[model samples]
Target: MLAIGMDLGGTAVKAVVIDHYGNVLKTMSKPLGQHATSIDEWNWKGVVKSVAADLMEEFKGRITAMGMSAPGICNEENTAIYSMPGRFYGLEKFIWTEYLDHETWILNDAHSALMAEAQFGAAKGYKHAILLTLGTGVGGGIIIDGKLLQGRNMMAGHLGHITVDADNPELDIFKIPGSIEDHIGNATIEKRTYNRYEATHELEAAYRAGDPVATYVWLSSVRKLSIAMCSLINALSPEVFVLGGGIAQAGDSLMKPLAAFMEIHEWRPRGEGVPVVVAHHGEHAGAIGAAAFAIRQSTK
Candidate 1:
C-alpha cells in the first residue's frame, strides 16, 4: 500500500509518498515562511489541503492513507496540539485531522523520528529504544516494547524538556529553564561558539581543526547530552540509542565525546555495551516514520 507522510518543521513542510516497506516513492517540500511563528501559525488547514491536493493529483489512485509529524505535543486522539515551542502558537484547540478529510495520524516529530528508527533504521528489532534528534532544539522519543510511549494526553516523550539542573537553569525563548534542549541543542552550540566564529560550518571546521574554544564548546554540549542519555539509560535501559538531525552529522565528533562521557557517568548494567548509533535515513526519517504509521493504521 502507498501512504503519504508529512513532516512539518519550523522552516519547511516536507511531504513524501512511501510504500508499506519504508521505500520512498516521491517527495515534495515547501518553505513555511516566517509566518510559522509557533506550532499554530502555519495555516495548518491550508497546508494540509495543499499537500492532499498535490498528492491526490500526483498519485491519482495510488495513495491509501496520510500521517503527519509535527514538532510539538500532540493530543492522545492524534488530532490537535497540546503545546509547541518554536513554530505555531495558540493552537490548543486546532485539529488538523478535521481539515484533512482523510484518515490521518498526528504525532510529535520526535516520536515519528523514533518510529522511523525503530521500524527501519538503527533501532530495528529493538524492543526498547530512545531516539534523539540534535537539531535547532533537542528532540527525543521513547519506545517501549515496540510501542511508542504516549503518556496521558500524548505528552510522554518530551525528553528535551527534562530538567537537567535545578538551581542554575539555562533559559531560552520557550521559558523552560534547565530544559535538556537548552543544554545541547543546535542553538545552544551556536550561541556558545558564535563569539569565536559566526557560521555553523566554521565552528564545525574549527572543531575538526582542534581549536580549543571550539572543542570546549562542542565538548560542553556533548557532556550535557551524555548526562541526559545516561539518565534515560538508567530509567529505560533501552537496547539502542539512535541519534539524528543536523548536529548528529558531526558524526564521530559528536558521538565520541558523548560515548566517553556516558561511560564515565552512566550506571553499570544499563550503560554496559549499550550501542549508540547515527541515524541512517537522515532528514527523511520523519517522512518515512509517518508513512509507516499511515500504513500500520490502514492495516489496523
Candidate 2:
C-alpha cells in the first residue's frame, strides 16, 4: 500500500514516499556534491543511507517497498549498475542490500521518468507511449500494451542511442555519431556553442529573437529529434510522446518546432498524429516512479 523511491541523480538524490494510489505522501532531496564524476561506493552508500533514513524517519513504518531511479544501465535483478557514463564508481562491487533492511528495485532514470509519467502524470490511458527527456542528455523509454518493455538484458530501451545521422560530428556513449542524444543533449548544445551561454535559457532566448546561429542550432537539433521520432513512429508507432527535462521547459518553443518537424517526417498515412506533450510532474517524478514501480513489482 505504500513505497519509497529514490532518484539518484548526478548532482542530487531525490527521494519520495507514495501511496498505492500514486499520491506522494512525503519527499526530500540531498545533495550528492558533484556532477558527472562518480563518488566512491562508501560515500555513495552513505548518501543513500541518509536519504533513505531521512524519509523513513518521517514516514517510518508506513513504507512498504523501496526502489531506485539510477542514471544508467542496470543488472538483470536491478541490484547492481553494470555500466554507465558517470556511473557511481565501485557501485558494481558494493551492495546496498547488505546495509539496508528493505529490498530495492532499481531502474534507469529515463525508464523511471517514463514510469512516472505513465503512472502519475501524462499518457495515463495510452496503451503505447514513449518519453524523451531532453536535458543534460536525451533519455527515453517505451510502453506497449500497458506494460514497461524490457529486453533480455533489461537494457533494450536506450532510445537516445538510436542513430539519426551517419556523418554528424556529435557522438553518443557508444561513440556513434549523430545519435539523438549527441545532437540534442544539453552537453552537445554546449559543445556547439563553446560555453557562450551558461544556461539553456540564453540560447533559447537567442533563438526566440531570431538569431540565425541559435535558430540553426536549435532547429537542427529538433530535426534530428524528429527523425528519431519518425523512426519510432514507423517501427513501434507509439500513441503518445511525453517530453520532459530542462530544455523541454522551453515549452512551445520546443513543441511547436518539434511538432512541425515530426509532421513532415513521420509516416502519417491516415493523417493521425501522435500527440507530443510536456511532462506534468515536477522534480519528484523519478522518485515517485521508483516508489510506484516497486509497489507494482511487489504485487507480481
Candidate 3:
C-alpha cells in the first residue's frame, strides 16, 4: 500500500507518495498561500482540500494512510494542534481529520524529520538519537529505544525554546528570554551580525576568510549551541545527533568547532562524545518522515 505525506511549511506545502519500503515515489508541492507570520484559516483549509483531493484522486484505493507534518504542538491524540503557532496561528485546536478520508496522523515538523532520519537517514541503526534542524528557527526531536518521544501533551521535545541564558534580552514574542532559538536561529544570526550577511553560509565564509569580527560572532554562537548540546548529551545521551536545516549546510565549518567543544565539554559517563552528522534528507525529510510515521503506526 502507499501512503500520502504532506509537509505543511510556512512558505510552501510539500507532498509525497511513499511505498511500504520508505521509498518516495511521487512528489507534489505548492505555495502555502499564506503570510509568513500568520495564516488565514479558511484559505488554508481550501488549499489543503485541493491538495488532498489531488492526492486522493491519483492514488485512489491503493493509498492506506495520509499524514501531515505541521508546525506547532500536535495533540497527543493527533486530532488537532494545541499551541506554539509559528505560522499557522489560527489553527489552534483545528481538527485535521476533516481534511482527508484515510487513516491519518499529524506530527510536529521536527518530530517528522526525526522519524525520517531514524528510519532511512542519519539516525538509522541507532536506538537513541537526537536531531536538531537549524534554520529560521532551531527545531529538535528525540528518539528513545527506537521510538519518537511524544509526551503527554506532545510538546516533550520542543528543544529549541529551551532557556539556556536567562539574562538574554532577545524576546521571542515579547516574553521568552535567552531561549536557544532566539540566540542562534538563522534569522537571529543575521540580525546579530547587523545584516552583514544574508545567510549563515556568508557568515561562515567570512569567518573562514579570517575576518576577526566574523570569527568572534560565529564562535560565540557556536559556544552557546555547544553548551545546549552538552545539556542534552548529559540528560538524554542519545547515540547520535543529526544536524539539518540551512545553517547546518555550512558543514564542517559548523561541525568541527562544535565537535571540538563538545568532546572536551559534553558529559562522558557513557564514553566519548556522540557522532554529530548532517542529515541525509533535506527539504523533503518532513514529507518522507510523515509517510514513515503513518507506515509505522499502521503496522503497530
Global lDDT of model 2: 0.82
Candidate 3 residues lying further than 4 Å off, grouped into runs, are 34-42, 84-86, 170-176
Ranking by lDDT: 3, 2, 1
**TM-score of decoy 2:** 0.93
7-118, model 1: which lDDT tens digit per residue? 8776677888988778788988877667745545556556666977798789988889888887777876777667774447655656766777777887788888888888
Clashing pairs in 2: none
TM-score pick, better of 1 and 2: 2
lDDT of 3: 0.83
Per-prediction TM-score? 0.89, 0.93, 0.92
Model 2: residue 20 alpha-carbon error in angstroms: 1.0
Question: What are the lDDT figures for the candidates, one per model?
Answer: 0.79, 0.82, 0.83
- Listed per candidate, the RMSD to the true structure in angstroms reads 2.7, 2.1, 2.3
